[model samples]
Target: MTEAPHNDPAEQTLRELESRVEALVQFCDRLQEENRLLRQENEQLRSERAVLSERGEQARIKVESMISRLRSMEQAS
Candidate 1:
């Protein structure tokens, strides 16, 4: 196919395209940084939640044991 002529309009279009590409690159870089920080925060929160769940499970086991002991004592008395 034949190429289009490079007139004033083509030059203007190229400049606009360059400007848009630069803006998109900058935006993508910022978004990547933010996403990295969010992922780190998410990992940390997950770790904290895991620890809390373990503690809750321990507490539940302890409470159940205590309840069973109380029932046994009451039955004996």
Candidate 2:
């Protein structure tokens, strides 16, 4: 036969606390995983930004050189 459920106040409160703790532990684990993923993504973005910035600087230098050559030719003509 199935035993009757406990109606004790202290036991009920303890069970509730246990449930809350379990939920909190799960939530913390999820947050940690999410934080790890975000950090990885941030690092990748930083690397990409650095590469793009370098490329932009190179392009700017090339453009300036072209402009200087054009000015020189104009002045000679």
Best-performing candidate as measured by TM-score:
2
| lDDT per residue as tens, model 1, 3-64 | 66777798879989999999999999999999999999999999999999999999999999
**Clashing residue pairs, candidate 1?**
none
Per-residue error for 72 in candidate 2, Å, reads 1.3
Q: How many clashing residue pairs are found in candidate 2? A: 0
Tell me the lDDT of candidate 1: 0.97
| Predictions in order: lDDT | 0.97, 0.97
Can you give the TM-score per candidate against the true fold?
0.84, 0.88
lDDT for residue 2 in candidate 1, whole number 0-100: 72
